[model samples]
Target: MSVEVLSFGCRLNAYESGAMRELAVGAGHAGTVLVNTCAVTAEAEKQAAQAIRRLARERPGVSVVVTGCAAQIAPARWSALPGVARVIGNADKLKPEAWALDAAPAPVSDIMAARGVAAYPVADFANRARALIEVQQGCNHRCTFCVIPYGRGPSRSAPVGAVVAQVRAALEAGCQEVVLTGVDIASYGPDLPGAPTLGQMARRLLALVPELPRLRLSSIDPAAIDDDLWRLLGNEPRLMPHLHLSLQHGHDLLLKRMKRRHSRADALAVAARARRLRPGIALGADLIAGFPTEGEAEFAATLDLVGEAGLQFLHVFPYSARPGTPAARMPQLPMAVRRERAARLRAAGAERAQQFYAARMGEEEAVLLEHPDRGHTEHFCPVRLAAPAGARGQVLRARVTGADARGLLAEAA
Candidate 1:
């Protein structure tokens, strides 16, 4: 059997999994099950462990190698898990030599000492319409509630030439859209010579890879968006209009307590600026529904921000306390409160999403066909075609016919 990768967590993890699969196969590791894990929340780690055990149980003789944020942070725990053949760290997972059949069973390294992100270009992602190019790696900021920095290490960017090459490879492989992803994409370029901003690098990439149909960015910090990126949002047609902000909370006090770089006012300003620059641009955010010391008023503030910021999409988390994080040491909210607040926030987001989708009725959109009957619009809204439109990876101009609870309904124009 071919080597299989089970990935968890962010888009970056998904991207890395593709690279890891290629490496494992190239290194002649057949019949291997690679578990790429996430450490964003305790639940995320728990799910990964469960998957590892299940995979082991189902494929009794297969080799299971664990890697990713969770494995990088706790190699001993993952290695001790039944049927795990090896445990690799984030820093070594992408390196070709680490995937060798004879490589050490557990060679997890010191992530904090890592200083650069080398481009591991993946030509294609299995069953994915969009290709993900990891523009940067790790993170420097230490948010009170986030353990990702510890798992990932310091911020480091892939060189501009490397990124362009990766994008070109994806285009050649018939990907219609490419998303530049990372742990903290907004913090790209400071480590590189000339210190080109994320926007500057993007501008260059588009110019170099003019054949690329659509370019998108993964979640970005509202506090760190550069002027060049803002200009791209305003003028670049190929750069998609959807922007997802890493806005943890909407309350100023909660924002401060979380040690986030941006304030409530700053987040509002960023959203307003994005809309002003690109009219009809779809906006989304990552919001923590309940945090340490969160009360009714604080939760309400975050709920209100959904409409206030015109957020059409939301990634809401019910504040899972990660061990060793500062927030875990603080007074914690009840699990019931956290889950309830999360439901409320998700409900608000769904309501706003329906509104956004309804507003797009009759508008012409460029839809990238991920499936024969379904794809997503330029705004990243899911659209179910009235009929089989085109082959997967083909871009079609379509007219929005209706909207529903799932997403927009469209027909090819």
Candidate 2:
């Protein structure tokens, strides 16, 4: 008779899921299952649908409430799913009244008309060691291959004071690390008064909540990185030395087709700048393996960029065309070709990751323990302690002892 939440997609969605669970449980919606879905790809939507059906079969009488990008974009479609009692939109999902026992069903409003990011303060992240704060919401740019804007609405930023308060709350709750996340985090300021950039917000947050030990950012668009953020990367020791860029493709032509603002050269330069500012910074990127009209040479360019950009952690996805995206109407690559290319890109990334881990041997790293024996370094590299390090959420300094396919082996320093 307890409420449960199932989340898919980005860290932002995961953060929202935490808020949704609180709202549902607070409203006495016991025995309900909240499904926070993703709509990043056609495959993602299909998988969510499959999971929903499975949940219905396994838990016969549990009321299933669906929300998130998938539900927001197509409310009727998700509402029509089996065992679904209600389908809330992203706009209404976090509101306290939405989960009320007598609240109206399918309370989806116009997401595009939404403005301002509300501070959804979460005390803890269930079992997570790091807390995620949504500093921004939605996207202003319409990438040819993306449908997130329609699901998440326009770009809006949480006020600096709210961000600081959230970080302070997380620190008080014993979270050692906090990650600032959003849909297009780099597009964080335009809608706000005075238009304070992401860097300015982060700087202010750190200054206000000085006890916050570590600060990290989710994926950021390379083309929009503000100067203040770059300065923070160079000077702020608390800011983790990990940068994950939203560099979808490495070929200029493919990037242009995707309507990405940054060129391949721009991505490379950003990577270079990060390394220069924060030496030995671990870099990560999101690279699509096969987009519509991607040729063998174009795929090779991306494969090569992994090495050139020194990306140690990679999130590689084979292109899954959304039905209404501009990419869907272009000359599409075969599914097999897409999958094969994705595999190859993954292999290249894996090799580079191994090399990066090897280079970290004997270096001292402050590890934030998510479990008694496992944690992640400031570089965001996973570490397994030779023996128990400490309790979850404890930050301990460790020296890298060895490297394995999974990550690094460490000993408390």
Candidate 3:
């Protein structure tokens, strides 16, 4: 029998799905395919549904299983969709062998995760400059606008040993870059007894492969990072000089409404300190525009803080109401207003990114050369060129000459 698990959204889901694929292949199933799914935004959800429909239309009789945040959040919605012969929740996906005797079982697991894997190993097929390593699951913070916690449950972490194992595997798989991901990466170790902090986890991962290049932490909370973490980052050769601290809003009032732990000033201080340690480090943040009850001044402050904090990348999101969230109940701005804000913020982000890339022009950048089929770069900014006269997975020093709307433009210096 042929079985394929379709997973969606987030690196944790990726790790889980990878483990599931490994399970299928190990079980001697030759027609196993795992389709990873993502639904962070409505666009992601639409793509996933379209994929399911296409698969159903093109291939019949192949056992299809749907799993991940999208599946967990709306079981009935996904189950009702065609082509999904089985619906497994993320909680039980990794342990498919335990779910049923049939090589392809239907409705294997629900909202709960399946941790029935001897090892959570991922395929080394990613062509990007960085690899996303999931060390944790779930989120403790129930931000009014997010449905992650509702779908993923409270925070749970992979064993530290397992994390190190994964890191080593990624390195051996020829990934020069690694980014640790989770719904709440900052809350990584609390579930484990005497769990290591985010910084400690990075420290250990780097220690395992001291020569490992370009290690990064993803979407960490400003409040979670401290002097010790900064010191570790500054001292570590492998850790990248970039931080993506999630600042949902810049105004204190808006932050309160979002139930974020850190205020604007606190987030600013974190940026200041990080820059102090490494002038080359790129700072990034996620801003929500036209949020409920967000006044003109609140939005203005958000814009102001991006400049004030000197973010390298601004991921601006327009407010959208989900079915089960407090923000959905709150009075939202009109569609026109939300879209206008989003358009303006997106433009601003583009200009800022252009300026950031421009500054690197004529400067020496240590780029981790990746396969040129996509783009390649040392910094996260990607660039496309005619397939370079070289193989993939090689890092080179390139001097930035200009900016491509996509990323940076450069040549061998």
Candidate 4:
């Protein structure tokens, strides 16, 4: 009769799923099936809906509750689905009482009205090597191609004290690393008391949690980095040297149409600055392909950005037009064209990644072994090693031996 959670989308959702599990179990609704969804792309929502139907069929008679960005934005649509017993908003999903039978069958609320983030207390991440601490919630900017702002509400910061406590709890629970995550992490703290910057938050967290061994950040906007955080990139070795940026497009015109804040020049500058501050740091970015008016020349700029930005890890998304987004109303590109451009970007990303791994073939790195056969380096590059059974969840020194399309191969040092 235990509650089961099926999570999809970002690492933040994964963290929230864990919290939801705790809430469900604590509320004594052990037989409920929770389908946490993502609404980033139309395809993501489609998959979530499909999964929901499959789960309901397989686990008959159980109350199937759907939540997450997809459900939050379109509660009526999901509620009408065959097997869904209820639909909850992103804002209400974390509340313990929301899991009770007396809770509304469709508990969607005005997520935009939420002034602050509710701290969903979690004791542990059952099988994670690292824990995610959500320091912010929602987004203030309305990127032309995004629907997440409406789903998540305005930006709200968890008090710095609450964040520190969460990290401390994670460390005490034996997590090796803690990743600070949010929808738009770089925009953190704008709504809080002092309107402290993300950089200031990072500095304070590290300084206050002196025993914290590794602190990582989720995807950030290049335009929002503050001076204090930038300095820490150079001085703090514990602030893991991997930065994943949200760089939607490489061409200025496309970027402008997408309502992005940074220019291509700004991206290149950040890449250079990261490397200068921390040698051998891994740079990752999220890039999209085949925007409405993107020409071959525009596509070429994005392809060239793989090298120009020195991106070692890339997440390339084929543009999918969401119904309400501004880009959706613009002249749409053919699906085939979008996918082909995405493939090209991925190929370039692979080439750069291999080059980065090859350069580290003879170097020594501290690998955090998440599994018996796999782990990642401080730069967040995947490394394959035959780790001892006892070494899982432990960080060990390793010497790299080779690189291939898969990842770097290493031997325990």
Candidate 5:
């Protein structure tokens, strides 16, 4: 079987797909591939469907398996689609070996952390410059809008020691940077014996690997950051200064309806503190434009607050309630309304992003040289340089040449 895996949705899906690929190869069906499914939104469903059709056209009757949030939510829908030989829910992931086309993998008697921690593969991905290590999986918080916790099993955290081991392994494998990812990364280490928080995990990792080149964090819940975390992050050069905070709504009333723990003031306080503690820090945010009963006044307040928050890059997405969540029962804005709101927020975000890039025109920022092909700036701005291939790993002080429709350009300073 000629196996090729396609993943959709969050980093957890990537981790699960990676593990599935590893086990399939070990089962003597080395060539067989897996098609991972995603279910973040309705758009994700359409994309997964299109991908399935493309895979079926390429190789008919291959052992195509679909799994993840999409499959979990609507297995019959995916199973009915062409080219998918099997559909596995979260329960099926309990034993990845069983899904193999032929022979099952031998159970490992002695394992690190727990037996299922490595349920997903983490091998043969040496080509990428950045590796995302999913430190935890699943979410416990019942955020009214999210479907992830239901899609994944009860919240599970990889062992802290196991996570550190993975980090060390990725570093040894020549990865330039490691991004700690998960559905709810702030809830990391909760399922383990000790239940250390994300801040503690980060502190421990920084202490353990004193010389690790770069440590990047995925978006974190504002409620999770504490005084200890801010203090630890203040002088840590290895820890990336860029922080992506998820602030879905700006109104305290809307936040309450969304079931988020933090209030509007709470989020603003965290962002303000992070900026004050770290000067010239790049702060990013994820904002939802339209949710149930989010009137024009509420939306306007959100826009006002976003500007006041001093956000650099904003990922503005309109709300879509998934089934099995509390928000689905709530009155939904029409598709036209959703689309219109999304467009307005997106336009605002683009203007803000342009301003941010423009401000960095004369400043010298550390560029983590990704590859001869493409790379990203520390602030998540896309960058391309006139430098040579040797500039892959070295941090180059690049002078911003220009910011076009595509991205910012730089010359070696």
Candidate 6:
């Protein structure tokens, strides 16, 4: 094993893992394992720690370097763990010099003080049908429940030229789709000169790279939708009509407590506008089931918002308190309560998703084949091809024949 990166977290982390692999191999480190951890929830942290212990025991002598959000936030904890050779912070992961075999055990700096965004140019994602481009890094917001700010530091965006070049590289590498991802994509360009918005970046990228077949954006804050993005939804044919919103809760008070910028009305309006512009667009969201100080009514409002917002794909997270966050200091909910509410929310989301897939039955869609026999439609709905659809990474049109709890069943049309 030359280099293997165990990535945990968002699409941004997955993209970075590729860069880490490249950096590790280039640094002459073979049989090395890098664990990229997440700091989003306590469970995520626990899993990372467990993996580290397991790797040490099973692999014995392979170098185990911990990096990413979890490592950045608490380097001492990971450094103390046995068999951990080195701990790299989020700020230094992409730097080639940082991975030097003879370097110190742990080299972490003040993440909040870091300002510049470094470009990690990945030629292609290993065996991925689509490529992901990290347009920006870090978040500026101090959401009471989020530890990402500390883990990732301040928001910084890559220059427009660098982003365009990355997309060009992805396209030239035979990738059909490219996804623009970041910590807070909506907060892009604020730290740079001229203050370009994410919408502007998307337009520039699409206009400059016409050969690019499809483009998608990862989770975006509801409060950050600008006029330019709305125009893309209304006009850009190549831009996929699917968006995953970063809406933490439904009730205004709970959202306020979470320090989220968008309200219930704002979320509803954004979903409505997206559909109005692009008919039959799929709207997905990230919703937390139980937050600190959340009452029964607050949780109920979140369940109702799924219908009111017309959300089709729901990423439900049961709130897990992280140390040093404002929410963690507040009155807490029982562990059982959080898990129960999460299940209920997931059930509701499943019902809505089945309805959405059922409605697509008999319609023709251009599905991007991620697997020989499976693919995802333009709306991001999963489809199982009736026959092998050529090869992986080929996009083909298929007629939806039926719907199941999993997704749509399609045959070559």
The sequence of per-residue lDDT tens digits that candidate 2 reaches over residues 1-413 is 77888889999999998888888888888889889999998888888899889988997877899999989999999998899999988888878878899997756899998888867798655566899999899998989989899999998999998888888888777789999999989888777889899999888888888888899999999999999999999999999999999999999999999999999889899999999999999999999988999999999999999999989999999998887889889998999999999999999989999999999999998999999999999999999999997998999999999999999999999
Q: What is the C-alpha lDDT of each candidate?
A: 0.91, 0.91, 0.72, 0.88, 0.73, 0.89
Q: Lowest summed-lDDT stretch of 10 residues in model 6?
A: 117-126
The candidate, 3 or 5, that scores higher on TM-score is 5
Give per-model TM-scores: 0.98, 0.98, 0.89, 0.97, 0.90, 0.98
- What lDDT does model 1 reach? 0.91
lDDT of 6 by residue, 1-413 (tens): 67888888889999998888888888888888889999999988888899989987887887788999989999999877777888999898888888777766556988988877777689646577899899999988999999999999999999898999888888777788999999999888877788889999899889999999999999999999888988998999999999999998999999999998988999999999999999999999999987988899999999999999999999989998989999999999998899999999899999999999989888999999999899899899999988896677889989999988889999988
Model 6 spans > 4 angstroms off = none
For residues 1-413, write the lDDT of model 4, one tens digit per residue: 88888888898898898888888888788778888999888888988889888876886677888899988888889998877888889988888888776675655899999878777657866466788998999998988899998888989998888899888888887778989998998988878899999989999999999998999999999998899989999999999999999998999999999999999999999999999999889999999999899999999999998898899899989998987999999999999999999999999999999999999988998888888678888999898985553356688888899988989998888
TM-score of 6: 0.98
lDDT of 4 at 336: 98
> What tens-digit string does per-residue lDDT give for candidate 5 at 1-413?
54578888766677677766666666656445566777667777788899888878986876667777777766778887887667766545546456556633232221112222443437655655667887776667888988776676455677767777777776776666778888778877656777778878888887887657788888889898755568766977777778988888889889999999988888788878888888767788888878899888888877777678878777777787788888889988887777787788777777777787888797776676777634777776877776653445556667787886567787777
Could you give candidate 1's per-residue lDDT for residues 1-413 as a string of tens digits? 79888999999998898898999888898889999999998899999999988977887867898899988888899999999988889888888888777876656889999978866888556466799999999898999999999899999999999999988888777898999999999999999999999999999999998899899999999999999999999999999999999998999999999999999899999999999999999999999977999999999999999999999999999999998999999999889989999999999999999999989989999999999999999999999999997988989999999999899998999
Cα-lDDT of candidate 4: 0.88
Error of model 4, residue 356, in angstroms: 0.8
RMSD of each: 1.0, 1.0, 2.9, 1.3, 3.7, 1.1
> For candidate 3, lDDT tens digit of each residue in 220-268?
8888885557877778756777888789888999889988899988988
